[model samples]
Target: MRMLRTTLDHVRLRDKMLLLYFLCVFIPVVLTNLIFYHVTSQNVKEQRMQDISRALEQIKIEFYREFEDAMEISSILYIDHQLNELLELAYPHPADYIAAYDSYLRHMLNNTYSPVYHSVGGITIYTDNPTLLNSGGINLIDERVKSLPWYSKIPPGRQSKPIFVRTGDGTGEQQHPFSLIRRMNYFYSQNGHEKILKIELRMSSIREIFHNLNLQGSLFLLNERGEIEYTTDPKVDTNAKAVAYNELQLPKDTIEFKTNYVLMNSLNGWSIVAAMPEDEVLYEMQTSRNFVLLLTCANMLLPTLIIIWITRSLNVRIHRILKHMKKVKNQRFELIPGTVSRDEIGQLTGEFNRMTLKIKRLINDVYVADIQRKNVEIQRRHAQLNALHSQINPHFLFNALETIRMRSLMKREDETAHIIHNMARIFRNSLVWNKDRVTLREELELISCFLEIQQYRFGERIGHEVQAQPEDLDYLLPKMVVLTLVENASIHGIEPLKHGGRIEIHFELRAGRLILTVRDNGVGMSVKQVQRLYNYMQRQEEMGERIGLQNVIYRLKLYYGSRFELNIRSALGEGTEIRIMIPADRE
Candidate 1:
């Protein structure tokens, strides 16, 4: 997890924006378009299959209608007593049969059932009467007639109902015609001659019915054995002999739709099959697919271009800002030279320019002047310290205090000797100006020495306590800063009280800052006086005092700048409390 954050931190803004675009925009658009294309193509394919199914059903209806008409004609002839009599009549001469045929069979051919039933080409009756003429719709059932394919293939039990069959030579070289044949035995004859009725169906009419359907693919009438009895496929000849369904070389991706012939007894298990290539079934989807692709491209292209433009704009502006920021390290406060826009980056650019200008002015007008002033102040302070040191030699002073302390101890004045010892230590610390910073522990020691000397002067009237954490003792601060505050509290707050007072000094570290609080239970000031003291602390001007509260405030200001804080609270008849806060120096 840390490694990913580190890697991303180093990546440029432009590349990051592009990555976002790829994830949030590009992938989703592509997936959506793909799903849309798949769904649309599937729907189109299914609709095509349905249309083919409907076309095959239509073919079945037309096929049965034609066969039904032929059956009707055969039924009419089955009960025709006149036609039966004509076939059963005996003829002694060919001339007599010709007279009978001219009167009945020829008239029947010209004006009867054939004219009414247009689906049939002609109706012929075959009989085993050798006396009948063979010229007029009647053929003598000799051995040759009995040997025909259609006659020999009839089922014996099918004599009661009309039967449908294809009438052609055994060889598949020529077109075949369909016929309905029935045994005409409704009326018994004296001669007991077997008779058959054959109605030849019109092949041209059936072919026209198939062609007019105008389907997109091949259509076939398959028999019970899966043989192609008839087809509207241009590749197969309609007039040719039947072929096995599997023998045709269909397309590899062909789709077939089949509907069975349910209403006709002769056509049981037969079906009309439609075969269409997969490409043809989905032909219209080609245009739709291209449109979807083009739409997908359009969807992706515009946004990608937009992302590029936006990323480029952001990268260029941000890079310019970064370049200017680098120049700032070399103290080159140059303003960015461009028309600032109203966007967030533009606002950032505007803010940066203002900050640069302010920094440049500060360096020229305030920073250099403040450094020179601080230098002169340090020199004056050092000179004053040197004059004081010249006046009071530190070695002579320490030796004189030691001599006085030994005399007091020799006379058995142990308390006086201790007072002299603490005074010597205070003088030693006051003379040292080489180190301006000291640890809290060292500063507290100096304050203890000064407090001890004051205690000697006031005896039982003055009381003081110093509280501090062991860990907080190492924090560095301006030398004598806390001592000065403690001294002020003792002299001004405690010394004025008749019964005397107690001074408490506490040191603490909190929230990366050092806190030094001094409270005195002595004479307190009014609110107005406390407010006046606060005003004095805030001012940079010198207060005409030596090593007092103002001195401590000034020294803290120089050390910690505006980061240090001071608060003074005093109330009439109550103690005064002073709190000082500064940044802690752990090192």
Candidate 2:
């Protein structure tokens, strides 16, 4: 079953559809034709059997007439008074008795009964009387009479009923002639005499019944035990070699005619059976079958061919659409041509064409729009840097000038010159805002210059430290991004303490990400204040302020999308820590 399922799964839709059609149409048609042939053949066979039976009946009628004539002659002789008296009278002399019997026999054989029926051959009388002579139509009974097969069968109670037997050759030959025998009895005289009358019929009488009969079959005349008495087939000699009814090997079709209906006073269970071969009986049916098969083939072939053609034509169009969809999967948008028909496949093709066009247009529009948007974002970040740098420049110059004036009054000319140089370098970095990005080393150098200026202004009260891996020094970030974070921690957290606090700047690499932290120990701000500042950074919006930190957050968002992270931690009188994480692989 699993193998069958796998085979079906691999089969294409066209083959599956064809298989479905075969089951729905051709298989049923073949089955129906088989059923039709079976039913028709059965009906034809039954009809042929009926025809054979009717023919047998007609033959039966013709043969029974001959048998009836023989029966009629026997009945007439049973009541013949003259013939009986002649046999009963006592003869005083042998010559006179013989002469009297010859005259009576001649009269009966030549004029009385023989003239009535032409089928009878000869009639003879066998008697035990001593006066009777063994002449023509007369025989004296002796030892041979008791030895005869019909001698014991003759009725002895004066019934005068006839019995049929085969008469052997009188000269002891094996040739037989059919005969009927009857026992004769005295009516009045007490002569203690007995006589047996035998009438032989010509064998030609039985042969004439079968001659020129219009039938091609075998015929059997069966006797009391259903044994064959006679058969029209010359090959069968039932008298010498008998055959039983069941052993006849009769054909499938047969008809039987019984002798009881054909012969009056018939005591034997005799029947005339006729059998014809099945092939002969069903000749017409075979012709009809051949013609039906031809018609069925023509019927099945033409339509099946036409249906397959149509199925393939429809599938071809569907497969064409499938090929187009495959090309679309590879981003090759091409249209199907001349597919606008009224059918469902045509409609699908039209819809597919339209969809490909829409997809192509959508991709082009989004592509151009995305490039333009990236250019505008870069220009905006550069503008924000310039504006922020220009705004912080004058404030830094005022603080540096005041620090230089204080150092000069204390007579520290070298420190004043160093402060001036650091301030000048800070201004130089601010002026070069054309490049939106710089290496971490460059940004750290600028941060160092800013810290030196601040240290000169605050003296030993303000201390700071910077630590970073040498490998991280070459990593690129937006210009002054680190500097802004350090500046914010100093101004907001460290400078608020009366005893100035220390600021620490650390750069490290962790888990393929760059981490920059700026921490200060001073009077820390409240949680509410830190929360507000972090929310403002996330929203990138503010009403009354455009702080440098906000600018840094916005530029970081633009450069790295969502790949950078910033976190601020602060508490009252403890410290503030700001940690920023960015992708290590960033430019």
Once model 1 is optimally superposed onto the true structure by TM-score, how far is the C-alpha of residue 462 displaced, in angstroms? 74
Best by lDDT: 1
* RMSD vs true structure, all candidates: 11.2, 13.0
Each candidate structure's TM-score, on Cα atoms with residue i matched to residue i, is 0.56, 0.51
Q: Considering summed lDDT, which 10 consecutive residues are worst modelled in model 1? A: 168-177
What candidate 1 gets wrong by more than 4 Å, as runs, is 1-12, 169-176, 212-214, 234-242, 247-249, 326-334, 355-587
What is the C-alpha lDDT profile of model 1 across 140-176, one tens digit per residue?
8988888877897666742567777777632352232
- On TM-score, the leading prediction is 1
**What tens-digit string does per-residue lDDT give for candidate 2 at 226-338?**
77666777766565555787676554565443333434455345667775555676776897688668867977898788888989878989999999999999999999988
lDDT of 1 at 354: 98
Clashes of 2: 0
Give me candidate 2's TM-score against the actual structure: 0.51
